[model samples]
Target: MNRKELEQRLRQELALPYYNAKIAERDYSESEFQEMKAQLQADIEQYARDYVNESNANG
Candidate 1:
């Protein structure tokens, strides 16, 4: 997927609850959030690099 699509999918995935909540809302922990952020950042950078390389080769 493209960068925008990838990011949008990630956002949707984050909204999904991984655990059940009896009285409180379910959400990601600090480590989980950080891991997700790191993955997103890496994917974004890879996408940008790929795009640039493809454009250069096409030209």
Candidate 2:
């Protein structure tokens, strides 16, 4: 998804109500979720780079 779609989906997911209190529950607001979405996207990019580097190095 693009940046706008990610931001929109994050807001929609945050609006969902929680049915149970679990320790693994995320307690972030809409803004925080947006930030997390960006961070995760960045992480995926970094992971791909790392994988490519490792593969090239091994080859």
Best by TM-score: 1
Kindly list the per-residue Cα lDDT of model 1 for residues 1-59, writing each as its tens digit.
43444344456655533322222334545565567557766876899999999999999
Location of the lowest summed lDDT over 10 successive residues in candidate 1: 16-25
Off by over 4 Å in 2: 1-27
Candidate 2: 10-residue stretch with minimal lDDT: 16-25
Best by lDDT: 2
Model 1 spans with C-alpha error above 4 angstroms: 1-25
lDDT of 1: 0.57
Cα lDDT listed for each candidate:
0.57, 0.57
lDDT of 2 by residue, 1-59 (tens): 44444445645654423322222343456676567757655766899999999999999
Query: What's the TM-score of every candidate structure?
Result: 0.57, 0.53
